[model samples]
Target: MRDLNVCIIAFSSTSQSVNLYKILKNKKYNVVMIQTPCTISAGCARSIELKEKDLDAVVNEIKQNNLEIKGIYRRVLNDSTRRYYYSEIDI
Candidate 1:
């Protein structure tokens, strides 16, 4: 499968984002998450990225766990700007 560089999993609130961030971090998904960037604003206070494959399972778990998800955005960064791609899975 093609590799996915950055995946943004956004939550509905800082508290929610924190909790999800902790859970995902502990699970160790080769992706980095940071506080919500100025470019995007929503119920989420932060965003996370994991391998494309991990997206489905993570989202499922988040749903089962009752974690609020604002949205899941897929992005590809090149020379200067970032491009957005819609995804049902993580990548």
Candidate 2:
């Protein structure tokens, strides 16, 4: 998949990432824990990555549960250059 896209989320704290990871996994959301991308300034090294199609439900659930998310990013490959399309969720 040359231009594959996926949804990514970062947290300020590892605990927060871990907690949200558990919540999403328990709910049967296809997800994987990954390192926070450098494009975003999340202090924590850990993050959650899931399929792009899961964005709406995952984002809604995160907001509803009051997860302190650093930000959300869409991993996009454009012209063979990888870039992160970000959205600030928790201010």
Runs of candidate 1 with Cα error greater than 4 angstroms are 1-5, 78-91
Off by over 4 Å in 2: 1-3, 80-91
Task: Give the per-residue lDDT digits (tens) of candidate 1, residues 1-91.
Answer: 2225556777667787777777777777565777655455644567776666777778876877788877776655443435444343333
Candidate 1 — what's its lDDT? 0.66
TM-scores of all predicted structures: 0.67, 0.80
Q: How do the residues 20-39 of candidate 2 rate in per-residue lDDT, one tens digit apiece?
A: 89999999999999988877
Local distance difference test values of all predictions, in order: 0.66, 0.80
Clashes of 1: 1
Worst 10 residues of 2 by lDDT: 82-91
Error of 2 at 26 (Å): 0.5
**What's the TM for model 2?**
0.80
